[model samples]
Target: MNLWSFLQDPASWVGPDGIGARIVEHLVYTGLSLLIATAVSVVLGVIVGHFRAGNLLVVGTSNAARAIPTLGLVVLVVTLLGTGITPVVLALTVLAIPPILNATSTGVREADPGAVHAARALGMTTWQVIWRVELPLATPLIVSGIRSATLQVVSTATVAALAASGGLGRLVVDGQRLGASGYPEMFAGAVLVAALAIVLDVALGSVVWGLRRRRSRIGRTAAELDSAPAAEATPA
Candidate 1:
């Protein structure tokens, strides 16, 4: 069957082994990895960015993480931990950490220095400054990092099927196993994965855009207020 035929077949999208089920499995893997990676990355990034400490450590870890190949890491992890979701999650989480950590750290570090100073001038503690001033300013970059990490995880989660775990990758691997006759299914799997990535990217982009627009509006309002002449002091 051709790619269209494969996709059009009702059997392709229903039942236990159907595309729908596989997509769900793929999302599970992606979601779990992102949750763990985001939680860890955000905390570390906050500490590093807010205090301006751990720069070398974060840089080293991000570099090392980006250097590792995702599929190979998955295979190696499975070999040591035995094939299961745990190994898969661990590998994917590793794949996801660098982008989030870097984005978050950069965002936090680059937050408005004036705002930080003002927050401090108000006697807000370091933690308060981070929570109230730095993080909010850094939100755009942090969200961008999450968006990037999410896309990476979505694309790489297909490797989950390599561990005999069921996901959209199962179709591609199965098609490969079946030779020429399976080409349609393989193509279909690839298409679906690409579509999923595009959808997620657009969605995240909208969020980033909205955040920037809101920030811009706030900046404009603040600027206008600052520039506006104070009412002439009434004669005492």
Candidate 2:
């Protein structure tokens, strides 16, 4: 069960239970968890952040999510729901929502009040100020929260294998079942999960970079437009 031997085995990379299939399964499970978590957390976070209320709720929920062990939660949910992807997705979603919620809330609250006032003075409604003014300003921290949640979900998604949800973790679970004879498979599975997490984090970082760039461009555009009226009104 040497590492080299495992790499040389074409059967490991192809077919139903092979590496490729497992990767696809892993992505599906991970994607669904993120989508559901993001939808719920972002909406709630935006509302709370805009209102600047609910710090107790945010802090309490974040602490609670961190305290719950991912495997235990997944197992409990699977036990209640019967063996399926639904429970696993729920567990991973729980793991993801906290950071996103916290970050979005903080970002919104931290946005400059003067800018918010200006938007209001300009006849922007509360929703308009939030959407056009606050959200753009809060994009960086919101992305940061997403990146943190993404890393956590990518790592924890492996637990899905324990609930009969096929993923790259299948190799590790199978290897563990076979004991010493399956050491190489276990090692390969661990490596794959780590590599996958790294890849996902890097991808998220790029998204953050792009969002910041767009924000910067928007600021520059606004600055130029503001300066145009002043430059034209000059007495000289």
Candidate 3:
């Protein structure tokens, strides 16, 4: 069966071993890893960026993480921990952290200095400034980083099947085991993963767009307010 035929067949999507089940498994892996990674990266990034410290730490760690081969890391982890969701999630969490950390660190560090100064002038506590001013302003970039991390995780999650874990990748791996007859399953699995990535990217892109629009509107409003008194005082 060709990829199209496989998709059209209802049987391919039903039952425990069907495409639907595999997709759910894939999402489970992705969600677990992303949840953990985002929490760790965002917190660390905020602290590092806000204090303007740990630049070397953030940069060095992110670079080192990026350099690690994810597949090899997964294999090694599985070897030590034994094959299961824990090992897969651990490897994936490592893979997902760097982009989010870097993006968040850069975003918070570069939050409008004027805004930070204004926040300080208002007698806002340091934490208040972070929660109210810096974080809101930095949201777009943070989300963008998450988007990048998500794509990486989705693509790499396929390797879970190698460790006897469940996911859409199982289709590809199982298809390979079946030799030439499994080409359709492999193609279908690849296509599904790509589709999932594109859909998620589009969704996250919309969030980024909305955030930018809100930021632009806020900027324009601030500019108008600042000019209003000057405009009134000027000679007509």
Best-fitting candidate, scored by lDDT: 3
Backbone clashes in each candidate structure, one number apiece? 0, 0, 0
At residue 67, what lDDT does model 2 achieve? 88
Question: 1 or 2, which is superior by lDDT?
Answer: 1
- In terms of lDDT, the poorest run of 10 residues in model 1 is 226-235
What lDDT does candidate 3 reach at residue 101? 94
Q: What is the C-alpha local distance difference test score of candidate 3?
A: 0.90
1-236: candidate 3 lDDT, tens digit per residue: 88899999999999988999999999999999999999999999999999989889888999899999988999999999999999999999999999999988898899877667666766789999899778887889989999999999999999999999989999999999899999999999999999999999999999999998876665555456556667889998
lDDT, candidate 1, 1-236, per-residue tens: 89999999999999888999999998899889999999999999999987889899998989899899888999899999998789989999999999999998998898766566666666789899888777877788888998999898888989899997877899999999999999999999999999999998999899998987765664454444433433333444
Clashes of 3: 0
RMSD of each: 2.8, 2.4, 2.5
Judged by lDDT relative to the true structure, which candidate is superior, 2 or 3? 3
Tens-digit lDDT track of model 2 for 117-227: 667666789899889978897888788888898788878888888899899889999989999989999988888888898998898899889988887775665556556
**Whole-model lDDT per candidate:** 0.86, 0.83, 0.90
Q: Per-residue lDDT for 155 in model 1?
A: 88
Candidate 3 or 1, higher lDDT: 3
